[model samples]
Target: MLVQGETTFEDCLVSLNVLCDVLLTVAKLMYPLPEFVLIHKDESVLKDIESLENFRLNVYKVTLSQDCELYDVELHTEPNYPTLGKKFGVKSIAEKIRQMTDTDIEKLLSKGESESPLIIIDDVPIESEGVHFFFRVVKQTQFEAIAKQGCVVLLDYTADAALKDEGRIQEITSRIQKLRKEAFFYVNY
Candidate 1:
């Protein structure tokens, strides 16, 4: 999780090396010879990967586009309207997601790479219809869906206030572990 520093890029690279060593040690203990380790590093951490571990680690750098925005069309849906207006069309949401995903696909394609399982992590609030609509669109696009992958995971830090009930953390952790076994990875931020 090291990022660009206030001074220079070299400092950031040094920080990333330190972080990667720590992460590699932890990963080795967690999984039995993990074939592919996807490190969500930005441009700053790219050069530092080689210096971190002796063994090869399959790294995927995440680059978020500045132009795209998550538009909540539900806000525009007027009250007393039967169902909703065409302005909140599922097709629009699907198109936006397609464009966003296409950017990443194009980058991979340029490097002569093929498609892999994708896991998206977001921290936004989830509403009922919104969740259903999103999953529907994702399925139509042929992307496998998971809750925390498609939405957000309630973190341990919010355990006391947000999820105060006893055994809540344990419950969430179990579910996350189940998902890890089935899906690409857990998006526990």
Candidate 2:
């Protein structure tokens, strides 16, 4: 799973492509055995894949349930006219996402099964103090209540320059490497 964030659509596409390449390389190196790799997303990034070569992975474009779709009001504006309408307030966006999440939870419960090992690639920064509160509420109210569920929430912070600087990237990469090594050690133990 890869999440990408940027002020411009092109930047987001570049970040996503880079992340995809990294993931593909890691998978190839770690697992020599043949395995299926799938890419799932909305149709937004379809054209961007034409530039990526050497990875023979199947891509699936599925429209998420209306409730599951996290709408970004920022993306709705025309390039020349960017204004937050009264209806497009931050509170409104949060409410919309929450409503959609609730609907998804209901649908999952009705099916009598859960989507285990579910990965959510959110282009939004989950570490923001304001957003963290909302995420905790969502997890406690809806996600955690679901049974037999495992979630990997990958947050992309490329939108913020401070978070994507060389030093920060190196720090994040080191932490991720440490986590992977620890997991491997535990598995081998």
Candidate 3:
């Protein structure tokens, strides 16, 4: 497990980038691995394309898989990417107040202190925004995505539901081969 180089110990444990790359290449040659591994942001409620794309790009930087067919720089933004908007802060008010009616502004301002729980900063209610990242491992035609955050390298292994059936099939095939080898049929008969 020791990599002889100037790499840090933390990099050795968390990253092991070069080793993982080599092992993944070898694994592909040694066994039937997935053809594609997709790293994507988790389920998003944002409707903004710019924001979503930016977040996905950030995720691509932290992802650790390489040499897979699913590795694409633009895959994160392929289907859709949401935009960014000011939610409930001064920015929201400044930007949206012009589009809102007088009644709408009044209603927002006249809400009771106990009306709803709000996170306020500088006396302005600011909406919270967050995005989760997920990994999708695809083998042949099957694929499933699992949500996670930060880095999503090893976490994809246990979350690959698409590979479970293949694993069982491989196991059964191996067992049947073993049984066939054990059985001596009429070869010369």
Candidate 4:
């Protein structure tokens, strides 16, 4: 029998085996992995998706060429929580942060000494004067253009690209796996 809070040697082995299986499945795809993948979902959409207590979405980036198809999937639990500077339409907070004096920075770090928007840095609480403007998360509607870039694949949640592609890739992966299992020409060799 297994205890509620305790883990046994066999339990650890099972966890490791599952991890290995996932890795092996990824390797079987045989595609050149990209350096990174980017996800661009609106804040409202993200919130709605998270409303389901146990539902976690799997977003995948698929690249296809004449002879190769690659699927890259990442599971992200943390939502994007930018500083209040973004929410307030402050063009560049980096410059303001850099210009702050050591004392001002210290105020943000002091326990309960500073208010929000000033003390929050990237969703983390800091100890600041005038820094309460930094704690709030940026609303996507107010600052979407700033996040766009060139050459990178952005899975935009507002459009069909992200949704359409994810379904297609899953279908392809399933078909490939089915074919591999059914192929029997090499059974004698």
Go through the candidates in order and give the clash count of each.
0, 1, 6, 15
Worst 10 residues of 4 by lDDT: 67-76
Instruction: Please write out the lDDT profile of model 2 over residues 98-186, one tens digit for every residue.
Output: 44444453443344424432212233321112221112213221122111121112222122343235445555666688888988855
The local lDDT score (0 to 100) that residue 52 gets in candidate 3 is 43
Residues 48-136 of candidate 1: C-alpha lDDT, one tens digit per residue: 54355555432222222112122111111112122223324444444433444444433432433132312221422212223212212
RMSD of 4: 17.8
How well is each residue in 94-165 modelled by candidate 3, as lDDT tens digits? 444234443443344345445552234345543322111123344433333443432233222232554655
TM-score of candidate 2 relative to the true fold? 0.17
**lDDT digits (tens) for residues 1-189 of candidate 4:** 777999999989999999997776654442222222323334554354345425433433332111101222211111122643445444344445545554564454454543554444445443333343222112333112112211123233343555555655775677677777788423344
TM-scores for every candidate against the unseen true structure: 0.19, 0.17, 0.20, 0.21
lDDT of each: 0.33, 0.33, 0.38, 0.41
lDDT of residue 101 for candidate 2: 49
- List clashing residue pairs in candidate 1: none
